[model samples]
Target: MPEREILALRQRNAELESRLAQRESDDNLYRFLFDTMDEGFCVIEFFDGPHGPLSDYVHLVANAAYARHAGIANVVGQKLREMVPDEADNWVARYGAVLRTGKPLQFEQELVATGRVLSVTTFRIEPAERRQVAVLFKDVTERRRAEDALQQLNDQLEQRVAEALAERGLFAELVENSVARVQVVDTELRLLAVNHRAVKDFEFLFGHRLKAGDSLPERLANFPAERARSEAMWRRALAGESYIETIEYGRGARLRHFELRFNPLRESSGRITGACLFIYDVTRQVDEQQRRLQAEEALRQAQKMEAVGQLTGGIAHDFNNLLGGMLGAQELLRQRLEQGRLAEIPALLDTAGHSARRAAALVHRLLAFSRRQTLLPQATAVGQLVKDMVVLIHRSVGPAISVQVQCDAQLWPSFIDPPQLESALLNLCINARDALPAGGMIDIKCDNRWLDDSTALALDLPCGPYLCLSVQDNGRGMTQEVQEKAIDPFFTTKPLGQGTGLGLSMAYGFVRQSGGQLQITSSPGAGTRVDLYLPRHGETPIARRPPSEAPAQVQRAAARILLVEDQAALRMVIGDVLEELGHSVERAEHGPAALELLESGYVPQLLISDIGLPAGLDGRQVAERCRARFADLPVLFITGYDQSAAQGDGRLPPRTQVLLKPFELPDLVDRVITLLG
Candidate 1:
């Protein structure tokens, strides 16, 4: 019995010893693993504390990593309240919940003691009644921050997408409701989008429906001209050019005027993407402008007709008055002769002669005012001419009115008739003298003026250099009303019969006819200033005036002459004068008769002819025919026309002389003798 019991006991002891040895080895490995783990690991045991039952914890087993993650050293067997007393309350979510639920809990929280965020997992250990839990955690501060940033980015992207959609909706609404036609096209002229108005207009104009994504060239293929025009404009806009232009569509009554605005679509980098066209109809505006222009033209025509009527009426009244004066004078002469008042014969003849001279002067002035008077323009030294006439002007104005003449140095030469200028000067002085009844001052001045476009327009003359002749008088000035009508025919400010009233009118017309301007500046109680703006001679070289010589006079004897005249009385009187002057005379009633007489071998030493001849030839033609037979024959023109017209705007031909009608008999004789001898 003792041998069997001893063997069983020995086997049991060997088994127990081996089991104890394996257990110790496993414990050592666990300890090594726990100490070397990267994550902080600890075993916490719950206990009753100041907070309440099972409300606090102590670290029963903590690895070396606990200090690295939790920033607390010597954690083994330490109460949480003792290790981190300040942050002990912050871990209220730990151990208690895991122990109650017996489930693993995962959470992230910042360890205020170390100022680091920790990701933590904790669970109740085996046999939960012992009130211990295992906690594993790692620092995750950077990872949590990145996750929060990602969430924010997702929210912002959603909001931006919503805004883009709203903007697109607004753009569509604006295009659909706009009155103008709109189309957006890419650089290749492919339509990206189009409004309803543009589609309708395209269909109406080109008889085809227009749609988005349609190539513009394809839509306008049937209309080659339209395609070319649209393409040209579209290319410019696609090249980043924005502009407004006008376009016409349809024809005649169906035509529409459209204002087109082009805009370019560009990218963020200023790269051109597309072009947009906005077209608005402006047909009504164009039609209105045309109607306004037509109305203006019609109004101008009506004004011209009214002006012509006034001028014609004035001419008839003045002409009849002048004719009556001449007729009355002639009737008185006849009565005196019938009564045989020999002593009064000379006085009656003087009266008739004076009336005749007045009639002639009236005709000349009327012609001047009408701007139909002939002009003989020559480059004249105006300053020298004014100086020469100062003595005459002073005499005409009289000693009571002091006349001051001042001319600018280096004055330009004016192209004008010297006699007419002299006559104009005398007329202006006389007017000034009349104004100066109380004997004021008269200032005659001349200077060169350069008129720019605006100044010339104000003066109603062409822009150029000019010579200004000014006549100023410090006398009783004309009122606004009087100055306005100063250039009108028969308008006068003087007492009855004292002034002809044609002074200003004649001067104004004459100046205008000579390519110049006449301006009057006057105000009541101030003074009157008349300025004559004459065109400067265009030639650069100053004209040197030759010394003037008197016409040569010859003895009136034994000179043969041929005369051609149209009027019966004038012809008879001229023939009698020629015979009395001891000249052989031949006469014809018209140019044809004169030519016929000349063809009959009647070649006289001198040819005298009237300008207003009948039968298809005037004095100029008669002279030509007469001179063909008698070369170098001296020809005398007796005409009512002024020398400006009789010579046809040029110097008279060789061996020619001109005498206007109503010229003195003695002057005529002198002319004739000079030509014949």
Candidate 2:
């Protein structure tokens, strides 16, 4: 040992101590960092073969947190492939890159083995002692879920926005096409949008164009009160309030009712962005209310006319009864005088009798017009009916108007009252003659049709099959105003003395009562067409022949007669008349008395009974009783009431005769001889 060798050795030992201390300090710092880090830390070691190729990944170290997350114990020094087969190959490649390059790498990946999203950073550390890769991983599952939730919310928001926009577009289109006027404005009361109707109407109202950025139109100022109300509404709407109100806008000369609705449009931040104003014009509705009040007035007038008809019908019925007795007695008086030495007075009596017959015929016409006369409704060929009317019409009109028919042979049959229908045809032909003045053509056309529901509804009729009989005239046409009221009773356009106005009205009523409809169409310059729609009927009708014409005459008869009547005045007159006619007569007030007389063995050769009696036994019932007992009794039943009551349900006695009230004395006497003989 020399002195120089000792100093050199001592210097080397100091340097070596310093180097060892620095290495220990660096190791302590790395340990502290690994232990205190919040991030999970793990180290993976890659083994190399002699050929310098990587063999496999081995887990060399893992923090306590990393071990807990892996759900394993003592994972240190375990091969990664053996511990987690699913993540082993991927981690080996990633970690080997870091270890070989010594470059840091960071990426986000999902750990398949743990089903957790993670961000991992890997780097090589401490190459001098042991070669390994250190990886730091942070669980990112909650972050990923939050991002997914935000994305879903964004998608939903976009969908809602699209739906809202589509709804707005639909609303805009509806307002543009609506009869109502519509406008939109911002919170500042500046106009933003206006429907075409609103723009046109406003322009017409204000006499100006409405342009963008323009101030409120001058029309708004005309209605100061409405404008004030509108301003208040807009203020409320801007404050996020919704309201509905009816407003009147006018300039003293023009006025209209507008139903206004105000709504606020809000943004995502809950601030009012604009306002929507919807306006609906209710002028037509307002006008209709006024028309209803006027209609009420007209309805009252119509009711008054209906009351008059009821009263007239009742009076006429009673009058007919009295007339029948007078006519019957006069005929008997005339016949008796002719048989006596006072035959010269018979001519005067015959003249009086003839006047009575005329009055009776007039009563028949009254009953027919009122629709109270008995009708035997049957299916008659419309074309045939029209053709038959032609010859009669020519005579009735006296060659003034030519009667023509344009009917098809295939025209369907209709259910109608033949006699009354014939009378109606006569009345129409007479009217046509008067209208022509210089002669015109009258067309009677028949058609078969099936009216649909829409047409029937518009015509205010039943929806079904029908047969139409149309009467068209080339005479003077009526005005629209006249046609509207054509069916009103006694409302005639002719001169006051020229027409009664009931011809058309009676026809209308008759058609209506028969479950049918009538329509009249006329223009001022064009021809008039009167159409009758009758139900299609199937039952056959009895053939009708042309009417026979004859002068009024009374026939004489002789018999032993039983007369039954409830009215004392009528009973006296009838008994006197029968006695004057060379007949032995017995009188009874009711059916029971007549039956009592018959039961007592006072069998008369003839029975004459008034149909309506107060004893609850009518003339028909008496006839039924008498025929049942005698089986072949000659009976004649007379009535001022409905003839249908005697015929309904086959209630009339078989082989019995009937006389309608207000009959001529000749008709009654003739019926008696015919029945008895």
- Specify the poorest-scoring 10-residue window by lDDT in model 1: 155-164
- Which has the greatest TM-score? 1
- How well is each residue in 476-497 modelled by candidate 1, as lDDT tens digits? 8899999889988557887774
Q: Model 2 TM-score? A: 0.33
**TM-scores, each model vs. reference:** 0.36, 0.33
Give the distance in Å from residue 359's predicted Cα in candidate 2 to where it truly belongs.
19
Sliding window of 10 residues with minimal summed lDDT for model 2: 155-164
The alpha-carbon RMSD values of the candidates against the true structure, listed in the order shown, are 32.3, 33.7
Which stretches of candidate 1 lie above 4 Å from their native place? 1-325, 368-528, 531-554
Provide the clashing-pair count of each candidate structure.
0, 0
Q: What's the distance in Å from true for residue 112, model 1?
A: 68
lDDT, candidate 2, 1-677, per-residue tens: 99899999999999999999876644443343344333466777777644245657667767665754444678787876677766666776777777777777777777676777766766666452366666666565665664574343221110001111223332232234333455666667877666676777677665666654544624467667656766888888778877778766664558777777677766546777676666666654454456654554344334333323433544455457657656666766767777884755656555555556555544554445444335777778777767755644555565566777888767777888865676666666666666787888888888887889998987678888888888888878888888878888667788755555667776788788878888888886577888888888876665633223222244456678889999998788778766766778899999889889989998777889887877778887887788777887887888775455566575566556778876655566667777778
